[model samples]
Target: MTQHVNEFIQQGLRVLDIERAGIDDITPSINQDFAQACELMLNCRGRVVVTGMGKSGHIGNKIAATLASTGTPAFFMHPGEASHGDLGMITATDVVLAMSNSGETSEVISIVPVIKRLGVTLISMTGNPQSTLARAADVHINVAVQTEACPLGLAPTASTTAALVMGDALAVALLHARGFTADDFALSHPGGSLGRRLLLRVSDIMHEGERLPKVRHDAIIKDALLEISRKGLGMTAVVDDNDVLLGIFTDGDLRRILDQQVDVHTTSIASVMTARCITAKPEMLAAEALKLMEDKKINGLVVVNKQQCPVGAFNMHDLLRAGVI
Candidate 1:
């Protein structure tokens, strides 16, 4: 590589190293004020209004999202916008989380009087405890770092990382205090795959009624094969006259039967089916089904009702397409 490229790479690595060190330095400082911040947010009846400027604003937005998704009600308000008309978003019952590395960001500090006038509890995350923002806050979290990762010590690198970690710490502390579960997190993040895994149940994605691939106990292998092909699930469930599942025959079973030269036209599905097949219930979470599939080394499952009758059937492909994979 060129000398200039090598120098750039070295500088980037140094910056990351410094930022990581900064995060490590603030571990011991996460007491008292951290707890106070969590208490303030937990007691908040309205919402958390996070405000910042420039790069701090970007990090504040992400912090607000993390807090919101993890059970804390939070939203980001750019200081500039708040100065315009967005200050109406804040209520006296809410809590304000302000981010500023130097604790003296003019745009953020300028709005303190309005926030204070609204009687909203204020929590400040700043690298400088003696700075104006920290002194003005009800609870000041000292996210101090030794130095910036920027070689010139002018960029936000290490200071921003310290602030972000502090924000995460507060969110998680509140999340645990509120008994937030994966289901709760999923509810707030419905667009992501994690949401599907936690919120979706087998019944939500399984093929039910006419879509289920099922055959009677007396079904001929040819008829069962046709049902499997028609359903496109690569398997057909074998059940008794009363719809109680007896066994299942999959593409793997057909391959084994064909090796023995068992004629599909003459054979009965029950004769070649494997009983005691793995199954799941409609009430079970889809993520649990995924784990069962992985553990049993199987790709599909029959969803049984309380009577153990096959109410639905689904395969790995169904989960993959449903965003539960």
Candidate 2:
């Protein structure tokens, strides 16, 4: 478009490239120290106490959260606050993870002796391995960056990104070590959309009781059509005397029947309904139900109990409203 706009775009992409290359440079440090740090946290019986100063504090906070959500229990502790009585939050069995780009933030360094005295394992992530904090820690993982994304090289850009990605790498490593599943993750994030998809069941959103569009197998086509219209599910389940789902008659079936000019008043629904319809169970995960609907090229499903009796019914619209779609 314009020269100034092109310069702005180029500058943004340049910064991104610098940050990505900085991340790539961090790969070699995922060696012994990193493994030992992960092992220390994994075997720990108590929580991980993460501490930092300034921008590192912000990155440490996010790291702590990622670790907690991924099955490694952790929390952020401001190093300055920790010296002022917050140190009590850490137990002898706990592990302390400290972040400092220079490996020499005074606030974090001042509390190292107390952490050591408490007999807590210390892990340090720093841009300089030879810094004081790294030497004091039981394990040190270098997060050195080759360049800063900042044009003036005065801001915490690439270094902070490296630390954040390192933290995520640690969290996911622990998550896999514990065999953490999506169900476990969902429990920790029940308010999020992922939780809804994993935790919700067919029975939770399905229409049951009188809301179900169902009719006897011997019921006339007109009766089934009335049930479909009343239930508004675009389909009707044909059931036997015990309410076991025998077949399904959908609007598609109605279209075919109309083309044949079948007498609605005289023809039994069982004669034209599609038997052996795909069905879902009441306890089936809502996400799984959606997969079934998609793979079978259908829009709705009937939830049946163990006895093959129709318990509930739902369609894609129901899943959309439930946020499972």
Candidate 3:
């Protein structure tokens, strides 16, 4: 049993090695054809129509999604369905990206003439350059693999990976061509951690108005402690009459002052507070603020305006809840 298990592991490794070699072989093919494919999709006035069948269909779906999220407008269509009503999804303004390892996937080959009739530019990805699909396309990108990871040399493993990589190459190239920014990516992906990191601002999560833990500079240490406890932020801002931030007194400061036996009821907050506190701007990205907090070795920050007035406050817990952590 142990010997059998060892063989299984070795077989998996061998498969990986073969697939890696296949990918390496395709690296040089990121050539003129690849460039033309990108340019065609970039200039496409309509959505990219990606189509294939079987394993190729699965890879096509992923390519379509990556293209859509990165900047290109694209969606996958089953070549089998294209013969039915789904062909209507493709317009003369669109571009068709067809994939087939053999360059003879019957479903994909069957749609070739119809795609041509619609006046849609066809870009084909295939391993066999001389195959029908390759010959029919306006531009042919060769994703040929020297070998399959499958011991029988039949599974789609290496070829699918090469095709997937080719799709990513095209999407990223188009992304660069269109000047697609991370902000634009965030707009497309508003629910994930990427969106939280890119789209959320300090002002969106910080405690504002009456919720701000604040005490007058002239107020006693006891007043600041009351504000901190009431606000539950572990710190209180020592501010002037205009609410401009003067200093901050956190629990860390309170702990240090405990060793000095300071009188909480009598000592003015201004005397005990940190005069120069690290602060964040309301417009600052929350993820950038998290990095700032990590670099400064602090857990909380006061959100200030252009004039340095305290507008809001936040802590590590807020970042965790907002998924910025």
Candidate 4:
């Protein structure tokens, strides 16, 4: 049993080594042809239609999704469906990106004539440069691998990896050319956690109004502790009569005071609070606020307005509950 387990591990490692080498071999293929392919897609007035068959189709689907999320309008179309009637999805203004290991997929090649007739820009990623698909394309990206990870060399292992990496290379290159920003990506992925982190503001999840934890600077530590407990924010903002931020008191401060044997009822919060503390604007991004808390080694922040008045308060637990952490 031990020998069998060791053999299994060795086989997995060997497969990984071959795939890595295949990826390395394709690095040189990122040449003029790759740049031209990106240029065609970047300048495209319509979407990029990606099509492939079998294993290549799966990779094509992922490539299309990546392109769309990164600011390039793209979608996957199966080659088999294209011949049956889905070809209408392609427009003259659109660019057709076809993937095939051998560059001779019959379904893919069968549509080459129609693609050319429509005057659509054709970009082909294939292992065989001399194959029909490559010869018909305006731009051809070579994704040929020396060998497959499969011992039989019949499966589309290393070849598919090379093609997928090339597709990612194209998408990222176009993303840079278009100056796609993180904000733009967030817009496309609004339903995901990434979008929540980018789009949520400090005011969105902060405890405001009566829920805000705050106390007057003249208030004793005991009073601030009560406010903190009532608000359940683990901290309380120290403010002046005008509601202007003065300082902050937290559980950590309470610990220090207890060790010093200070009288919570007589000691004013201002005297024991953090005078020069980190604060966040209500309009600031939640992700930015989270980073500030992490960098300053604090667990909470007081959200203030332009006048530096405490308007809201939140802690690490708030961010976690809001899925911003």
lDDT of each: 0.92, 0.95, 0.93, 0.93
For all the candidates, what are their Cα RMSDs to the real structure?
A: 2.2, 2.0, 1.6, 1.6
Candidate 4 local lDDT, 113-184, one digit each (tens): 999999999999999999999999999999999989999999899999999999999999999999999889
The 10-residue segment with the lowest total lDDT in model 3: 147-156
Candidate 2 per-residue lDDT over residues 1-325, each given as its tens digit: 5769989999999999999999999999999989999999999999999999999999999999999999999999999898789998999989999999999999999999998888999999999999999999999999999999998999999999999999999999999999999889999999968889989989899999999999998899999999999999999999999888899999999999999999999999999999999999988999999999999999999888889998889999999999998
What clash count does candidate 1 reach?
Answer: 0
Q: Which stretches of candidate 4 lie over 4 Å from their true place?
A: none
- TM-score of every candidate relative to the true structure: 0.91, 0.93, 0.95, 0.95
lDDT of 3 by residue, 1-325 (tens): 8769989999999988988898898998899999989999999999999998999999999999999999999999999988998999999999999999999988899989999898899999999999999999999999999988877877789899999988889999999999999889999999988899999999999999999999999999998888999999999888999978999999999999999999998999999899889999998999999999999999899999999999999999999999998
Reference-based lDDT, residue 182, model 3: 83
Between which residue pairs do clashes occur in model 1?
none
Residue pair clashes in candidate 2:
none
* RMSD from true fold, candidate 4: 1.6
**Deviation in angstroms for 210 in model 1?**
2.2
Question: Model 2 scores what on Cα lDDT?
Answer: 0.95
What is the RMSD of candidate 1? 2.2
Candidate 1 Cα deviation (angstroms), residue 3 = 3.8
lDDT value for model 4: 0.93
